[model samples]
Target chain A: MSNTTALPISALHERVEAIFRKAGLNAIQSGALARVITAGERDACKSHGIYRIEGTLRTVKAGKVKPDAVPELVLQEGSAIVRVNAKCGFANPAFELGVPALADRARACGLAALVINDCTHFSALWPEVEALTEQGLAGLVMCPSYSTVAPTGGNKPLLGTNPIAFGWPRMGKSPYVFDFATSVAARGEIELHRRAGKPLPEGWAIDADGNPTTDPEAALAGAMLPFGGHKGSAIGTMVELLAGIMIGDLTSPEVLEYLGTTTLAPPHGELILAFSPQAFSAGRPGDPFARAETLFEQIAGQGARLPSQRRYAARARSEAEGIVLTAAEIEQLDRLLALGLDAVS
Target chain B: MSNTTALPISALHERVEAIFRKAGLNAIQSGALARVITAGERDACKSHGIYRIEGTLRTVKAGKVKPDAVPELVLQEGSAIVRVNAKCGFANPAFELGVPALADRARACGLAALVINDCTHFSALWPEVEALTEQGLAGLVMCPSYSTVAPTGGNKPLLGTNPIAFGWPRMGKSPYVFDFATSVAARGEIELHRRAGKPLPEGWAIDADGNPTTDPEAALAGAMLPFGGHKGSAIGTMVELLAGIMIGDLTSPEVLEYLGTTTLAPPHGELILAFSPQAFSAGRPGDPFARAETLFEQIAGQGARLPSQRRYAARARSEAEGIVLTAAEIEQLDRLLALGLDAVS
Candidate 1:
């Protein structure tokens, strides 16, 4: 692959599929994993895209995740709340099978929840949330990962850089979506800055001794701070309670301690909630999408850039002009492809 | 009432109850409203405590809110999602009526939502969420007020402080709960700082020209900043979508624009979501409360204070030692009690 050569989404997806297939994943698993990674790439999320492939492959080979594992329905709360046990497999496939059921159930019940437990969730949560939003429903997703952040005014890392995602449906336009980690700076982002030899902004992290520092290296060696201080830490705790306790999976810190850095894609948990506007808003005369669009316009009129606006802009630009990875990145991809995982090549 | 006198919770409740009863509320309504206000005062929440009595009186006097109005069930989606129309009255009464019903329904359905519309929510949201929490359910409450905070990167006020409250149930312990505004500093806090001749904190609010300022007066005249910039703004938007659009009530900016500083409450909306732990977590061997306690301990071990820990400490001290109101607060209470509307007084 040439550094200047633009790869279509289809091309990247195929390459990723080939890699997964080489790692013994079935077509369904390969396809599901490829779809998320491709979207990450298409949206210029390099950290979650090409950067994750090697780790995922290593996990699959090490038997930390069952490549052939299938998700099973464990419980149902009325017709609205459904729980799926992912059985120590990758989460994307479980979500693929569960989200449609979630949407259909929400349409009938007005609100629905798909609680997925015991899965290794290595991808961004926005794709599943946006899927619900694109179906003209409001979506909210919560997930807790390995512990990496210290609580407010505390030195030890006691919580994950938990991520929460939200999506609102819009008719004839892209759904409004946002996904963010609870930490002031995601560990991956700090690592990225360190790789690029860039100085971090203040208030992002602290030194190993718990003193605030602007050095990304020092912060990574120590612990990341929660965004917005105490408030963000509280939200992170809420995420752990909802996705961990509610779903009957190990909380973030518990997972890290349970695994002890020996595994990848170990059983974690996630929760996806969807709401149907039609069933709830009997008093509204116009479409709910129109109302949501009006609110979006109100913010836009204030000259504020919304999350979806930035994402869509980047996505559109990437889809048309293609993403440009560095020379080193292309070489790394080539090396990964040559690691006995490219039977087709 | 002497300013120097330390008042018991029962005494404060009695006075608040008398004021509400005098203003035409029935015993049930007066009791519910007094309970919340007393909690605020006991917790040292000066912003929502005695300070709000004047505004509540003004709203009642101006006919913006009907003191005698009652909330009635308007819509239900199976047993899980319910909507209540407040008949243009205060929200505390509506929650007082709906929460018991909500808890019952949530236990049956595993999850339930109570949407309140056509109401003036003049008090803190924590009370209603705490109600559901006490019943061994996870509670989430969302309420959007008149626009007072600016969208990130935009100077104009396009969203309210928009507090979202969450509570996690713990058996035989104070349920962990927190309520936070999307804005870094709420409007009422800025007013308090201005009155005390105190400087505003950095990153709290911007001047009229959208420039960051430490002067409380300048920030008060301008728009308040969201707590975590774009992230906070997005959360505020989520609250509006869930509370306003889904509940068929006016969104934040729309409400402020329609009222134009002419009214109090102005027919706001709120959404309360409750989830039953037993229904969601089938695999847990022991009580979910035990797991929750462990998580709380983990944080405490890290020297991180959880929300309920702090609140319960304050509540205990207040109950034992009582609270002392300032001379100005006492005078304001005196005037409020002497108003012509005070029939009970």
Candidate 2:
């Protein structure tokens, strides 16, 4: 893992796209995958960015994920409920197609719910929700991952550190976004710590015997704790029910098969909700966008940092000065580039 | 405080109504107050039931709550957004009037949000959501109380252990209702332990210095832990933002001024959401009610207990025989009965 000098984001995206294209991804699919990976890095989500390249490539090679598959829309209930059978993975055509339709339905219905099943892994939710808000629609998205944590007081892991993201539209300011895993800490964080040979924070995980453990390896062998304890457990349970059971995918037992295991294969189910304030309100006669902006400004002034502020700030920095990547991560990118991968195709 | 023997449910309601009437509540207001209190006990929510009578009387006497106040409807948009101002106290009337209208709007708009502000405590949210489901609508309700618990890793209590309830209508069965407080344990549980001289459960509360304590009395002097830790905290925080700030109520700090130091009085904000399944689907042609019943039976067979099963069961028992009350609680009822209150009108 020798360090390599940083490269411009464009260069990185091109290289990543080229790699996917080399692996037989069509131009559109490669471009979509590259955009998602690059966005993760731009937002400082290193674990979800190029760090995932090796695993993703392995999945592609193993045929666990299709490189050029398109999502099929199964059911549409006008602006209320839309179901998309992700023929491939979540990040490719599934997200690209489902998001815009969800936004349109939200505009028509005031609130819209989209179910994405059998889709590939969606790395970061913020970009999707943020994109919705940018289109004047508030977004709430949740995805139940492979089970990696136990219910409170339960010895066996039964639920994923399910993540939820909410984005609120603003007028002049960036949309307010809140996104976090339902666990005390995401399993990815534990995995990262394990990679770096670091101990986990107290209360974040429990060992095989259900005793608290700081050793990332031990936690990986055991279960992560819920975020707030019972409340978090309840939410995790709710997510399992809503995002998993409700969407017709793996239940508690089935999800457990993927625990402590890493693969680029798509998780089975994800739920997305998009809402339009105008659908519920008399469309912003006085500029609702301005009102939203004022609300965020007021919240920030009151010492409350809006969720996603840090990510948005990072994105701005990346756009201005280019994305920052570790030398090692850059080397990995270089290796892929030298292999003649054309990400953008 | 001395223990009062239990009495029949009818007697308890009569006593509570008498107390409110004597305290200057109008007939309808007294009846509504009695209904909520009696329902709390009926549903096994002892904390929100008869226990709140004395506190309510004191607040009314002190002019802290308006006994005869009425909520004013402020705005209505396609039933998607309905706003109500709780003149001063009286949350019941607003709930009674606004919920049905919102449900109807949801029937038309697919989803609806009802925001109520500046109201005295509205106890036991399950009943309200159940009522919405009875009208064939799904409901999600959230209430953010005044600050009662500190944020995780923060000493000062900065947020309320907000509660949220969700109810979905089944095709043929009782609506699935899930109602829970965001705290590790309800505030009432702590009070119960304090009165009974019992140790609280581990992980339920933390002392003033943020150390876990099982001593109820010490916990009373300290802070309740968020349910699931950070996950529950996140939900509570979301409730505060959605039901409190977004709905235009005073923040936790301003709300604390109105609620007393004890767990007795809490100034809180409540938000109710209603969604119509019919709006999503024309639903099968005939027997919409029958469809719900069938759905419930199937779910029940699958080991899914309907939310608020206890309440429904108790209601059935009360309807067939009579509502049961503890001897001590009954004695308290008799004391109130001595005021010569009329059960109806």
Candidate 3:
């Protein structure tokens, strides 16, 4: 009656998975994709939620990502590196297959890295780091996106929005997490501004001639700026070196070249590093977890909020009251399920 | 005939080391301290060069740092963490003692971490990461300073001007490196402004009452803002967690509490992560080093200057023409050597 549907978390996941399956994604791909999408919605991260499904399916239909490919795990024995070849599929399943082994290696070696290659990557990196936090390990995750951001002092786009995410486990509480794009603003932000007939924010972008511009159209035709000026640009470059070239995968410019457009998920790689507190803090005074809580309490005591609190709060709400979707959103979901790959351009 | 004198790199190192030794520093402390200070001068990084010698002696005179303490390395068998307890000494010597083990572990484990605990730290972090680059590895180094920065949305100094430095080895060129304070600017910059009787730029800090202020005096008594707002604040907090709390050492606030003054070096911990590119790129296609050069070339082609080029250029100049010190600098160095621990209050 209210033109909305309240679905339990599982119900929403089932609906999303069913849609991916109908679109010809294998069980592993569909399930992993559905989980991430559902988690996005649960956390109220609308940008990465079910809205990504169409683009994902479009990538599959365009022969950009392999729908039925399975991710392969290469456990480099006696080493701290765990490799996962995504087999041309989405990065979600690849991350899934690698997390357990990564956790094991981290515990045994005290620090470990998981490298996922040949993956069509989507979803916010928080989910990936949160997975490690759930396993009681501190983690860092990073990956390259297609080139859309210009290195500071440069005119053209050469660096990706290259996201970096970090998480620390907290006992009996939600983990401490932060994930962000190195760019001043995400490309989708400019897209929204363009659609809204709005001028972009100052310092967010530069025009075609490498001069600052506020017009979203000019910005789109030009380049986005990295956050924090050169510092952020340097970080974006480091991501290219570490998560891209160091992992033997496509850099952001190469990803853009491969895809030819930004509409579809880009093929690249991911790097995840896990650190064990028990191993790191061994023989040293103070429990790392307890000390971290004190730091968090002091931060809050000073009236500063920790990162990812809003997401965690929304997750709690979603768990209690279910995910409420509007009529239009429900219709879109239904249409996608009904028409499968034919629903997209 | 002139108000300036030029000293070869070796002469400067020997002079700085003699002053430290006269000030009661042991061989390891004097040698390591001299190396970094000379490197700073050689690179034209005036802020960290011979200018920092008085502060070093002041800290030593105040008994905040152990002048003769030895560092002990603890190699956890079968683990990727190589730790060095600085025994209340300077972090430089501790870092030097741990690097070889860290490098070995990184080569063997694909990734490794070096943790330096109980050290009085006062040098720029570029030297730490550069040491790893010298060993043909990619490295990241981070450390917490005394609390001087406010977390975003907080009005008080609840975080440190934590610095993170990263480096990647390059073939036949200077290694790629970037090191920076997470705060909008270093505390020293604000102090310099105070000395010059100048107002700070807007958004750099908040007054004691939690309102924005450009008065350097108010900013110092209040809190410096993190760079890039919440993102940089989060990174600063991460430094506290990983480098301070995770290493079982003092956090920024605790360091402030322990030191009772920001003028002296803070006793805390440092975390250095090393990655062996050969191990990481073993089964992957393309050479990581060569690929990084391509990325660098494109960035430069677009007119973006890579970080640390200026320093590398200065090093080249110093190597050719020696380091030039102004008259005041020469006088201060001679006085510090003459007076030793009595040079400062």
- Top candidate (lDDT): 3
Q: Output DockQ, candidate 1.
A: 0.65
lDDT of 3 by residue, B208-268 (tens): 9889999999999999999998999999999999999888999999999998999898999
Local accuracy by lDDT, each model: 0.81, 0.68, 0.94
What's the best-to-worst order under lDDT? 3, 1, 2
lDDT of 1 by residue, A80-163 (tens): 677777778888888888877888878877787898877888898888888898888898999888777988988877789899
lDDT of 3 by residue, A135-238 (tens): 99999999999989999999998899999999999999999999999999999999999999999989999989999999999999999999998999998999
**Top-scoring candidate (TM-score):** 3
Error of 2 at B122 (Å): 3.1
How close to the true structure is residue A2 of candidate 1, measured as C-alpha lDDT?
48
Model 3 chain A, poorest ten-residue lDDT window? A1-10
For model 1, what is the alpha-carbon lDDT of residue B112?
A: 78
Alpha-carbon shift of residue A329 in model 2 (angstroms):
2.6
How much is A152 displaced in model 3, in angstroms?
0.7
Off-target runs (Cα >4 Å) in candidate 3 are none
DockQ of each: 0.65, 0.19, 0.86
A1-345, model 2: which lDDT tens digit per residue? Answer: 234344577977888888777767777678888988888888887867887777777666666667777777754443356667776554556767777777776666556777776666757787777878788776778877765777766655656778888877776677777788888887778988999998999989988887899999889888887776555665666666556655555444454464335444446667777766564434223344454455444444534445666777988888887876777676667676666333221
Q: Under CAPRI classification, how is model 1 graded?
A: medium
